[model samples]
Target: MSERRPTLRERQRSETRRVIQAHAVRLFTDRGYDAVTVADVAKAADVSAMTVFRHFPTKEDLVLIDQPARLIAERVAASPATHPLVRRVGGALVDAATALTGRDGDEPAANERFLLDCLRLMVSTPALRARHLDSQYALQQAIVDALGDDTADPDTAFRAQAATGACLAAMHTALTRWAEDNGQTELPELIARALAASFGDDVVATGRRD
Candidate 1:
């Protein structure tokens, strides 16, 4: 007989990972990142320390997670080549915002709060801050890879870096402003305005040039 696939068990395990990560974030945010040991997190989540380590190798990963980076990469990869990288990235951001907005029945408020918590942790914790820089560097590499080697010459690389950096800066700035504004306006609108300010009318024009 053929070996049975473990799809159901795998999904249960995946859900467990998410649960552990969620509890870890809650503990880390409520206490301090440095103050919360893996053992403490495991106990809080009702899992063993080994189980926590299985899900997140490092304490920092507990806060950083993987969904956002993976989603951004997938979006970039799936975008059309006819569009400029800037427009493609912008469109990806819009898609991400829509996903977060719960138009597809996902919980936007909860996800927003999770992002806010992540931003807070990344800014406030030294270890997490370093991890954030590493993540951005990885993102830069991914952008270059997506653009392809033929298009990743020095000039193209520079432009890609600048474009990605501008978008990230705009995102951080918008999120900060939104936090200060008590989230009066939705994140998507803030993100759109920020991107427009960064790219101006030049997005299409720049992309069309030889």
Candidate 2:
């Protein structure tokens, strides 16, 4: 089935968000996250402070707002049910990250720069680093919701949630390394390597592990 195009309102909201984020990041970069206020971002975006708040609730959110929880959940839900939970969630997470970044090592330079800046902001700033945990929790909840009927089963829920947590941790490590290396290396490869090292083939690969 063909994907539905975004409606006019959706497009407008996205543009508004883009403008707000661009202004926010530039200001944050130029003056530092601590120094720049939401009012500053709002003014820079040529919008009201309320408009900026509507798009980004907390100051930390402007930097940490790109979590692809819905995308990850959708991918996991659409995957074959027969697959192992870890593989399904891990593959979905990887695919979602790849989708945001385009080809393995070749995301558009601007997009890559944006991600690098966000990653650096999250890593270097103490408050953003603390808020990062909440984003991870939100991602975990998304995976659990994607499990659907499986979430009702205690053992299945436990396993699914565990896998989600582990996968998110692996992803965090990969992202941090990507920032550390200045995005020179491919992110998908880093993420894949992290998952493999953390989970081993038995859990990460498909089919029975006999």
Candidate 2 residue spans exceeding 4 A from truth: 1-4, 103-108, 201-210
Candidate 1 residue lDDT tens string, 106-172: 4347767777677777878999989988987777667657666525578877887777777777766
Q: Candidate 1 local accuracy as lDDT? A: 0.73
lDDT of 2 at 62: 89
TM-score of each: 0.81, 0.89
lDDT, residue 96, model 1: 62
After superposing candidate 1 on the true structure, give the runs of residues whose Cα lies further than 4 Å from its correct spot. 1-6, 101-108, 149-155, 201-210
Q: What C-alpha lDDT do the candidate models reach, one value each?
A: 0.73, 0.82
lDDT of 2 by residue, 1-210 (tens): 999999999999999999999889888888899999998899899999999889888888888765577878888888778877778887887777777676534544677778778878888899988888888898798888987987798897888888788888998999999999988877776887888898886555551122
Model 1 clash pairs? Answer: none
The weakest ten consecutive residues by lDDT in model 1 span 201-210
Best-performing candidate as measured by TM-score: 2
